[model samples]
Target chain A: MKNAKLRLETCLSPAMYSKHANDDNIVVVVDILRATSTICTALHNGVKRIIPVSTVEEAKAKKDEGYIVASERDGYVLDFADFGNSPFNFTADKVKDKEIVYSTTNGTRCIHMAAHSKAVVVGSFLNLTALANWLIGQDSPVLIFCASWKDRFSLEDTVFAGALAEKLLASGKFETICDAVTASLDLWSLASPDLNGYIQKAAQKGRLAAKGLDDCIEFCHQPDFTSVIPVFADGDLVPVS
Target chain B: MKNAKLRLETCLSPAMYSKHANDDNIVVVVDILRATSTICTALHNGVKRIIPVSTVEEAKAKKDEGYIVASERDGYVLDFADFGNSPFNFTADKVKDKEIVYSTTNGTRCIHMAAHSKAVVVGSFLNLTALANWLIGQDSPVLIFCASWKDRFSLEDTVFAGALAEKLLASGKFETICDAVTASLDLWSLASPDLNGYIQKAAQKGRLAAKGLDDCIEFCHQPDFTSVIPVFADGDLVPVS
Candidate 1:
């Protein structure tokens, strides 16, 4: 692989996270419905720094320190937390200049799992191009690690990964895509034309819509909606300038 | 789920297998390139039973009991085995009227892991309609478990699963489809017209071509190439007559 060209590959779920040789590659964890997407939107909305924690206990600890703890389980806001893991609450009126301790059912766990990678980035349709452009300038392979719906393959995350992959592929910087990457790229192409119709019927659709989080879905579904490239560095999520 | 309609979901790899609640569902294990495809071809050629084992040692134990042992690793046929796990070798002249024991790098392990399920069936593009028709006849939910290339997602298996899912959905037997299923179904629709063109660039392509197993690729790519339905029953693979 030393002599090979730069590549774009996707790990569909955290379960397949171990299958990737991501030690040398940049990983973009995509949890489009909606943790990663929410983080991206929040960063774009000027939240100071987002700390993605693994457990509710970890989130609560930071809450005691004055950080607003946002925790979600099964697509609803935790009774003890300040907010849900939805981007609707990430508007400037709410989270501007604030530090958020975020914990979600699936997405935060994915962020922690990829903490040791060369670099971990949060991806969504919100910041799709920004994420892709940053990766194109890198010299190593790029692994789009989709933080699927609870270790199960989720369409929204895969679609976001596919969007980033498509952007990178169009730039002609990463051409050596694996089969899974190809499949996702194809899926993104198919879904791009009518994304709302496609994602509204997604696997993770009911969990949020049932909780009246359709606003979160519409917020995250906007293509190239935000330019905030939220990168996980030194255990915190910060915008990459 | 009794009052609700039967759903069809797909697990793209064994990595995603644990994500499935398949205890009540019938899992159709698919490994188009080529374990499931090969097993379907073999059963079509009148192979009485296919004992899918997880290890070379287990395959050899079956060999000692007069089973025609087939083993493959890294796309190569083991010296002690009668043949490699390729559909091209499952011609009528070789496997007809035989009871075979098979073990491959990824697919067999998936079969063994899913043994405790209510019932497991082998699926491939070759028996796409047959597999879908059988599922439509049943009332239970169906899980298309793709035996991905070593716990990682593979395009061929996913495409096969999508094709079957497409068929099932069209029959109106399965209305509740998950995110992965929708992705695969869309992928299948996109790749259906030029499947060979799509699969030839699959992740497993170079590995098999490097090992001179390109014949396996051509054989497995044929859509609805055969009508045999190989179902895992009584701990063995047998054709559904």
Candidate 2:
């Protein structure tokens, strides 16, 4: 039987997914801005574990238990937190063998919204190829849930979703049901073979540049910075072992 | 001072204006899937007037006053209505001096959402060049709100938005603020001078083909079918005149 997988790329917000809660499929939550990038970097640097809580209070509670607290809000690190959203904050020596409690503005909320999904995988550009391969192997429909900024669609996240969808279609692993998904694939195809340049010159990156955050944009655009697949299991973002 | 006018090709939703709702701007709503297309056809063909109500009941209530209820739900024409959503249904001879009470799944809702905008124009491929020229002459930010399928993103609508945005950029009339909109412009640039073929082979059109609705897609893709600009004002759709 052909796998009847449904892929949804959504920005992380309660408003985006609340309507589709009854959907029975795997939801891949993506927050490419800095959350997923930060998580991928931390894990690749040998962070033993990450407990992704939904609130700053929960992060603090976990910190009281002696875990390193990594939290961000409004694109900046909380004053008392040990880490901010920048991928550069997580280095190999700093995170090796250390468990951390983490939270973020949009990505964590997305994981919570997809808590009822059959499987929820944390996705970002860093592991795009691996996630695409894993989605093809799945027996269920795939939902590329983009954690869009707040509840609105983010260009980078949607493009990332489109890029993944394009890969899946090129691999001939699944069929697309939505025009948005297919159009996204078309957009990706047009930008393919030079996706990094595409990202650097994109509107979101430009905005960050105007705000003097080009470093963060460059860090997020780095491809295959890690091979770790972060899966939201039992309310925690653990590396796919 | 540089004219910081934003163009439609780069962004295609109300979300793009979320950060600048109070900014002086003109928004054009596009829904090629029958609403804007139908409206353009109706006005061009001699429909004396068109009242775009928000709900089926509102359309019926207007119909009770002897207006022709041309309503669509779920992309299908409701029974007991004088017309469905087909632009062909609104030819000059048929709609001459007629008052149409129209309601649709998406387009009208977008009109309502943009009711407070400085100016709201209905756009489609049917009037692509004319709309682009008009946008260039305006000083306010131009927002192309794609009346996506039932509030979800739709490729056909966004692509049309992208095309309009591309035209504005080429005319040197607007600056893009949002990343998604800029990406859309880039996507449009890559696929330009061949949009007709692009839309025909797009995923949405593919789905329509699967359902044997290729005729509708072909009809919707017809360019410059009408030169009239349909503007939403005073709770009705009328020619810009």
Candidate 3:
């Protein structure tokens, strides 16, 4: 490592996007609570493709094209949404061989922000090792942009970013790192093995669990449960086959 | 601890000021490399006051009022400046009972940005214990805004913030914390008992060392070297008597 050839940086929240989050870097957007976890789980179970639209209107627009609309607002299913963004709803029996047009309050917006990156990939604890393996094979710099709860720093999303940052740092593939990335790595190290307990007690857990999706918290914590990598390109998330 | 009554947040770089950096929070501006360290050192040696002006013109303007002008640009003393920002120059013999008006490339600018806060205080490794004690006595939310190198995050300022954050988190005064503060705490824990060695390998060390200020780095690394707290009020940095 030339200590400068490859660098790792993290945006603790997409709302904190500075010019440093340029299009030149490979962006791994992490929304561990549900969105990315759900997408990865759906893809691992043989979902055809996912349209990560920015708005519920856009997702519903894709509904006429035989895409199952999945949307959530404030952690609940929207009025007309077929399914809320929860991994519990993304089972192999239901979503296999189907298309999903998904939109959420925060995750979808973050995914749209990644449209200008060199490449956009979804990551969560559910596919931690799988995404880390894929990211390690890339030549470009990496940016982990956390889709925090409505731009406020959520504990779960940051811990997820920290987990990925730890993997990237340990690979010794990068020479330079920003403070946020370093902090994430330290946080991950501080809360290992008990990651589920950490998420269960996260400040955001009250708001999420209050929404009656406590199971989503548990479901998202299963690390490396799937080998599928859901990549965003051409405005849709497709398995990197 | 109400856990929500007092919150701690950190801006890794002054340039990364987000809307979450509320003006209502008590801002503790940290520049541990040499600026805050020098201020603590000078005040400890019985300096009357420090005027941390943002512009060279403002500092020069204060010169007419019999205040000693100290300024630095690009890690070296400006040609006409009375002194550069270095702890080596702030000794009891040279600065005792004197009024110093100082400006630096990055630290002073960060101090000026603290004007909107409920109160602004300077923090460094030198006054770490004293500053933490004072802040723990406060009831308001705290923000540790690190004055990094220019607009980017520097390794030194953040480490100082991390040190303070760890203290604050342990004090049981805070009810909530953002990821930045948590990360800083972890960083501080990871570098304990060897802060000097950590500073020696910092990314910013190369630039300062190249300027022949290696002695200054060593001086700033000495934790608890001072008991004075420099508070920014009415546009000047005055010792909190």
Candidate 4:
């Protein structure tokens, strides 16, 4: 008998992850409004590794150990962090060849949530194509896990999950019975024509814009902006180019 | 200053309810594939009250106490249940003037999740207008909580939330910063033209179809099929009409 098609599912929040978790699936953790995007950009710009911690204090302790830290909460940089949750903050000058401890209001925590999966990978539009290609080659079921805002569903991460699910479904290698995946694909179709205009209404968009940190909003939604895929390995996210 | 617009939000799953929970919000628990639809139908047909229990044992205990039970798990009628999770099974002949002890895989569990809210109401496309009109007069924030399938996002419930939110927002009496609400509105727009066709792709559609229990699929999507709004009071869901 022919092998069953690989299943592709989109989990809209970390709070819902327990239902979708599987030891055999490759978990793609996405935080489109910037944590995963920052990880992709940092790896693409030659950062050695990213150590994702769930708590701000953990990132702070890593800072005390002289490791650079990138932290933010509620759309603002923490007072003691070297940088906030922005892709531009991870450019080569600061993060290159250095191990950075990262924490955010949502995303890094999701990485920890998926820490027990067989494989955990960071995803954003910046690494969309590369990540999709890598996932297709893995020959396992895929679960696109969105690092939703504060364990509540967030639009941008889910939209990105739709974009990635669309690609995966088009490859003829995946099948899904997940309503979240189907709804997300529908959302992707609606949002793809004008991502910027569509995302302007997102709650986080307004929050980030108010803090003048939304400059990366469009950049974060730009598919294939980078070729690096950040794979979780040995307690750090390292580039898989 | 004018009073703030009444907040409208969608809680996509019972698992995510804690983050969106507030004593100030009126919670509308939805289980669109069947549970809430059944509740609306039962009440419209003159069922005295519904006692929703979260577990099969509780429902069985209620049955032992001589109350009629309506129960299902997955997509079939439980061996001990007099009726399954289908609205058509709830006719005046069988259910009128009777009190039902109801339990289902997802919906009943969700009702308990919102039991502590300011008010817990039942909603489905069957009672869409009556519920919305009643909510307009309540002068309170509304949380449309979807009884998502097994703690994961389910498409039909979210689309129904969008339909209700559209009505609530149209009254010009409500506002929302919730991304889940925004996304649901988008889904409603996409699905409204062909709700049956759109929902045909839902996983539960296949589940119910396999059991020969999806005859009410179209009826479940029919807006305003009943005017009874089931409101939780004391320990039972009594008709508010």
Clashing pairs for predicted structure model 1, backbone only: none
Better of 1 and 3 by lDDT: 1
Q: Output the number of the DockQ-best candidate.
A: 4
lDDT of 2 by residue, B168-237 (tens): 8777767765555665565566556776677665555665566554676667767787788888778888
Candidate 1 CAPRI grade? medium
DockQ of candidates 1 onward, in order?
0.79, 0.44, 0.30, 0.93
Give me the TM-scores of chain B across the candidates: 0.94, 0.88, 0.93, 0.96
| lDDT score for residue A129 of model 4 | 88
Global lDDT of model 4: 0.89
After superposing candidate 2, which stretches have Cα over 4 Å from the reference? A1-15, A19-23, A54-61, A210-212, B1-23, B201-213
Worst 10 residues of 4 chain B by lDDT: B104-113
Retained native contacts per candidate, as fractions?
0.92, 0.43, 0.27, 0.98
Write candidate 3's Cα lDDT for A65-133 as tens digits: 667888887776877778888888888888898888878767778877777889889998989998888
lDDT of 1 by residue, A133-229 (tens): 7888877788888877778888888777777887788876677547778878788888889988878778577876777776777778887888789
Q: Top model by lDDT, which number?
A: 4
Instruction: Name model 4 segments beyond 4 Å from true.
Output: none
Candidate 3 per-residue lDDT, tens place, B1-241, comes to: 4355588888766546664567778888887777888888888888888877777787778877777888887777877778888877777888888888888756777777777888889999899999999999988888888887656556678778778887887888775546566556656777776877756657567777788776778778778988899998787788886
Query: Against the unseen true structure, what C-alpha lDDT does each candidate score?
Result: 0.81, 0.72, 0.78, 0.89
Clashes of 4: 0
TM-score of every model versus the real structure: 0.93, 0.90, 0.86, 0.97
Candidate 1, residues B1-241, lDDT tens digits: the string is 5556787788888877887856888889888777888898888887889888887788778877878888986766777789888877888898888888888767777777787777788888788887788888888888888888778888888878778888888876687547778888788888888888878778788777777887778778777787788877887889875
